[model samples]
Target: MAEQASPEAKYQLGTPENKQFLDEQRESLMAFGHRFPSPGGSSYWLGDDGTPWTDRNRETWITCRMTHVYSLGVLVGHPGAAELVDAGLKGLRGELHDDANGGWYPAVTPTGDYTPDKQAYAHAFVLLAASSATLIGRPGAQELLDDAEEIFLKYFWDAHEGLSVDTWNTEFTELDPYRGLNANMHSVEAFLAVADVTGDEGWRDRAGRIIAHVTKWASENEWRIPEHFTSDWKPALEFNRDKPDDQFKPYGATPGHGIEWARLITQYALSAKIDEAEKQRLVDIAEHLFARAVADGWNADGAPGIVYTTDWEGKPVVHDRMHWTLAEAINTSSTLARVTGKDVYLNWYSTFLQYLDANVIDHKNGSWFHQLDCENKLMTTVWPGKSDLYHATQSMMIPLRDPSLSISVATKEG
Candidate 1:
């Protein structure tokens, strides 16, 4: 757990120096990700110095993230952001899409091999990208959103359970029995963006349903939400136990996700037209989730950063610190502070900002380092090069904006 520190002048969330730091970081991220687009419009994985890692496959999810980021860029008046968003939309509507099969492929290899499977994860990002681009009035974004919504409702979303399915085959004929919270978490994010941009209140209600199920599960499991699940949605606590460091699906509780969920839940609670009592209850749940994540993950290994994963009993599993986890922590803490008027969360926000400045941020290079070991030295075992600018870019901007709306909508309104 973090020892609360007094807020300093520069690290406080709304201070002039803090705003200047965020602006500079946002600009750097925009420049760093400028070279992400390939000829076909799919995103190229960026290396340490912001060069495109041409040998790696171009992933649809990465492209969607870049699309969403640049859309925010357009909202914030970044130059050439519209062109970048159009490039991402071109990829989404063209080469990466399965024209015949109807949904998106996970990735396209440099040699032109298409990775199979229609993933809920990738589709969720597609929806997010489309929703954000639509907000910025990008061409073809509404059509992309319509198609993404239809495909998600047809294949990924399980309306009966108020939850979503994990994956389907390329032809959309067979469904994978594996269920996961990771996709659903992002779906909550996408759903909120859809609701905000399209004025579809149903999407917000659907997101609330998913949140209800998650909060119940987390409450029963001592606030550590389970990640993997069986076909029937039973918690498969031992799914990846043998290989705990598997990139996407790890073995146990992911504290980063807990923190991320807290922020999303708060957003939903604030945005929904619910009664005051209900809103307070949801905010309480968000606070608990944030506290649990910070207590279990932050400095759990006698180190300064949040661990990537933890056991069911809240013990540290993977000691590596992911950049995205810290990003979510900073966003959630700032969000909690704003909604609750609590100085403790502000203290945590200051602490995270200080840690980010001192260690995680690549001061020489444009973007932050993707991973660090227990000793705070750079490590590439889990996340090699910086994949995309989605998380890092939002981390810099989210704290300065309102928490009730999605990042895209918040950027527009703020």
Candidate 2:
């Protein structure tokens, strides 16, 4: 990733420098855009404890944020973002496909050591990444996408149930493994993205089934879709307790649950093919998530982002106060407002954006800081200077308004 270069003499841009930067960097960026994903799976050799990220773990956050960037960057198409955009696209090409297994591996370090963890959820990321790369007409990225499709359909695709699973062992020894709504929804997203590009009806048809399954779960259950489950779609609450919030049963309300639950509306709003009543149901669900998040998770003084998790009592227990959640809220609420032509959603989003712009954006760093403490301070006690180019990259996942305007460039020192 470009972040490897470190903060060099504060190479920066903003309103005043717009013309100058577009003149200088635009040609360079547009010249070789969509090269690869950033921080491109380099070996950090340090653990989350700050010792070492091990060769394999380095790809985790980097890949995670790439998924975010690919989702949002296609339309944003901001001037300076093209560099990281190129890196992110190229990174996907680097960390994919192996003859040993039918599909791709997790990631590859800069030195070219391959890690063994291959998750379909991650491949789902490629559905978006490859689509973005293809949209931008990045060279040889089609091959990367082809490999992604091969592995994903080969390993994760379940024809009978019609959904992608969470992970697949490279050897193809285990099939029908753990399943979750997270991976399934993401797969639907990727599948639809490919459909949009290829005009492929099979992809959309399959995505429809996945969506139907999701909505089916909502109808039969108490809208508390279980996380992981047995082959027959049984509830897997055992792992739920180990999460930050013990017993994060997803029914009435949970921290960030509403925001997350509503994300499907944004993803499929264009093609759910729902009648007015069903569409209203989707809108109602999105609004419900916003309300629960506001009522349970909002910190009166801290502003209006959701918490990490919530309880049946409608209480929020936050472990990490993340910027991305707020970003998603913006995209979701804004999307709902736009699609439904409702002014209230826009009003909520406006206030949320103002709070974030005024308080959270790190002016000196040239991007948004990762998270804030409950006391409404930067979470320096945890990881100092942990700001990432991809945190901002990830924020752009939903295609924001005037991405250039929202982005903060390091001010050039006189």
Candidate 3:
């Protein structure tokens, strides 16, 4: 068993050494923002060689993530950060926006034609991006937030089901029967940000509803929350069994998402200031989710890292280790420590940091490696290049916050 350190010594997340390391990491991440802006939107992919892949189409999800990240950059006073944020605003206002369809497109070609699908996964990020930008008082951000909220309420939200639907046609005429926890998971995250920025209790209530729904499902399913579902919210447990490594809709439970949900639910519970009983219930669910993810994900595959997905029985399905998984594990462990004052969470935090230091951070290349094989060597089957800064950046920043504030709000007030 790992020896426990005193809380004063174990809370190394706020130490100056970690702060300096995070600052350096932020600097490296901001360097990539300069290459993201294009005519269509933020480019969907960046080559590992640190160049934007112009051949790849622009995507709303990537654009929104960049917007949210650069808004943080602006909050932190990074040089040239405002330019990227403005570029993202321009894209949201111009090409990505569907003047006829009413919601943003999932992707647009470089020449500016919108993709056919409008997805909740991407739109949730739009809500998040707009929320962060509005908090920073960016021009047009309020309008964007208003529009995103309207679209969400009008099209995606299924109040009867207490969850958001997965996708719709470009004109919002056809709804896909497929429901997904992934989109709702992100919706909870976006709702929290909206609540923080707008002081909207409604958004927080919606987040709590989603959290309650998912937590119930997770508890009934042995903590391996199902990702896919039908129109009436029936679990589609075998939705992607043939494609076990699909990037978005993988076959089995995503441990990273389990951990991510754990962190978000804890944040929601704290920020909403629920009654002690409700708060404790949320915390208990979060602890169970995190514990299950760590046990099934970390090193279950004869390697010293978290696997991307796991079967219902807690066996590794996709043995590849994703950088985002460890990032969320680090974040949830840190938050659990801060919330519960538990030494075990602190010990897990230290262990995750060691794993990240040895396997994930690409000290030679700048940002962390996005994916690795079972043996922990760099591999790029699912994700090519450092396409996102949101997860890793928050992993470094979450430890320094009050746990109630979303990362954007926390950074602004820090």
Highest lDDT against the true fold, candidate: 1
lDDT of 3 by residue, 249-269 (tens): 999899999999999999998
Model 1 Cα lDDT, one tens digit per residue, 240-270 = 9998888899989999999999999999999
Better of 1 and 2 by TM-score: 1
Runs in model 3 lying further than 4 Å from the true structure: 1-11
Candidate 1 TM-score, C-alpha based: 0.99
Q: Could you give me the TM-score of model 2 versus the true structure? A: 0.72
lDDT of 2 at 69: 49
Clashes of 1: 0
True lDDT of residue 122, candidate 1 = 99
Best-fitting candidate, scored by TM-score: 1
Per-model TM-score versus the true fold: 0.99, 0.72, 0.96
After superposition, candidate 1 runs with Cα above 4 Å error: 4-7
Model 2 has an lDDT value of 0.52
Task: Count clashing residue pairs per candidate.
Answer: 0, 26, 0
Which tens-of-lDDT digit does each residue in 188-215 have in candidate 2? 7678767766566577667767767765
